[model samples]
Target: MQAPQREEIHLNVPSYKKNRSGIAKFVVLPELIKSLLSLAHGNADVECGFSENAALITDDRSSLSDISINGLRATKDAVKFYGQGKVHKVPICKGLLDNVKEAHSRYQVDQEITQRILEKKEAIVAAAKLTKHKELVLVGKEQNLIGQRKILQEDLENVSKMLNEGNSRLEATVATKNFAGVEMAQLLIGGAKKKLDVLKTQLGDNSDQMNQLKKN
Candidate 1:
């Protein structure tokens, strides 16, 4: 049977309804016409190609990538259509020879691009890791400095208390007219004052270090 052209069907379909009493009277004919019109003509070659593509992907060849599968399909189709179903029967053209010669160069360029992208990713990751490490080090330093400051403040307070106690004892000794007790009290006060000065200086140095860490 011969199929009608799309233009002929488009012009003649409305006539079927006009000739009949109503659309319901010509229901099956309209449906048949619609089905025939909807079919994509000249698609047999494409459908055949899809079937051939599916046949190529066996269990052993399931890992083939889209590019590899496409290349294989093209080669097979070329062999069957142009080469008369044999690889050696294919004609050696200048274009084919040129593409063959340039394949290595193209592959090398692709490799360089891929390697550069990978290296850039690695460098970014390394930089992030270094920054994190530095941040952790700064945190540790800050905590250490804070702890040292606390210890220093405590020592300064204890030394100040000792100095005050020594001065009170010296006053008591002097009031009692005891020369030896006053001399001992003066030595104790001097030692406590020196320790208080050292603790103050250490605390100041710790504060400076903490400030520097913050700036970094």
Candidate 2:
């Protein structure tokens, strides 16, 4: 009995024997079968549309819009279906004539809407460019001010050191009771003090300017 069951499960088993054994196992089929079945048998409809569009949109009518193309195709289809493909045979009713008359007004409205949208986009792009230009200018100014501030700081440090050394020399000359040395040292110290004050003023002004720039 087991041998007979095993023989029935085999794919090479006779059809009559397999039917007698009930359902038999099946191997997985390739996906190609499903894909081939789903594919279109022909592109006749697509080709027909392409031919009609090519015939309607000639070199003279190359500038036709999508709406115009759709309208032309729709009118062609209507004539074919109702008038046996004859434009003269198609009946012209009052409603159709009225719609034709209103087409110019509708076209004007569409043009106005399109123009407004284009102008709005142009305005947005211009504003963005202007903003970018301002940012670049501001960064440049900040960098220039920062460079000036660094130079002023270095000058201030040098002047301050010179003033300190001159004061020390003046004090030593006074202690030694050297009249000529004292007079020369006093003159040097006074000059150093004046330069130090000027540098301090410049450094302060530079800092204030940088702060102002940052605020802006």
Candidate 3:
């Protein structure tokens, strides 16, 4: 019996901020959300099993369903955090979770297609064997079967290669997005602090002016 395959799940988070203004609200801006989403998509691709066997199973194909579920949860959490107006660090984390879900869905579809093609090749090879014909015909048919198998193998190889490339791309994209989000958040927070400082200074100056006017 074929051993039941084991799957490993991995998650990556990057350090990016929304901007350098140093305000918490500005840190979680829409741009930060966008970046987070992009990163999440990439991470999803990486963590989901992109193997040939994975392609055979319809449910878990690209592992997109898993990523989607996780992504939805993260999005929900992020929405809640933002609702509280507390400027919590959890929303960005949630965004990353959501990205995984999207990636899984995509992988599943690709696997299904590859599996179908392989199955068809197998069927053709089986049918070719039962035919009784002249030696030349048999040789020709066998050659054709061999060629078909090679083509299928090549397709499988291409799919594997593409998955690897995608995984690498997702890893980089997530890293970049994380960096951008963190940076932007810090920038916005800074801006808010500076604004408060300016306000305090103006208020102090006004108080001094009023006192001098009263004395005069």
Which prediction has the highest TM-score against the true structure?
2
Q: After superposition, how far is residue 66 of candidate 1 from its true place, in Å?
A: 7.7
Q: Which tens-of-lDDT digit does each residue in 152-215 have in candidate 2? A: 7888778777778777887887898766777676777788788878877887887887788788
Candidate 1, residues 80-189, lDDT tens digits: the string is 89789999999999988998999889979967997999999999999999999998998999889888888888888899999999999999998998888988899989
Poorest stretch of ten by lDDT in candidate 1? 18-27
Q: For every model in order, what is the number of clashing pairs?
A: 0, 0, 46
List TM-scores for all candidates, in order.
Answer: 0.62, 0.67, 0.21
RMSD of each: 8.1, 9.2, 46.0
Candidate numbers sorted by TM-score from highest down? 2, 1, 3
Q: Which residue runs of candidate 2 sit more than 4 Å off their true CA positions?
A: 1-65
Task: Name the TM-score of candidate 3.
Answer: 0.21
* Model 3 regions more than 4 Å off: 1-133, 178-216
Better of 1 and 2 by TM-score: 2
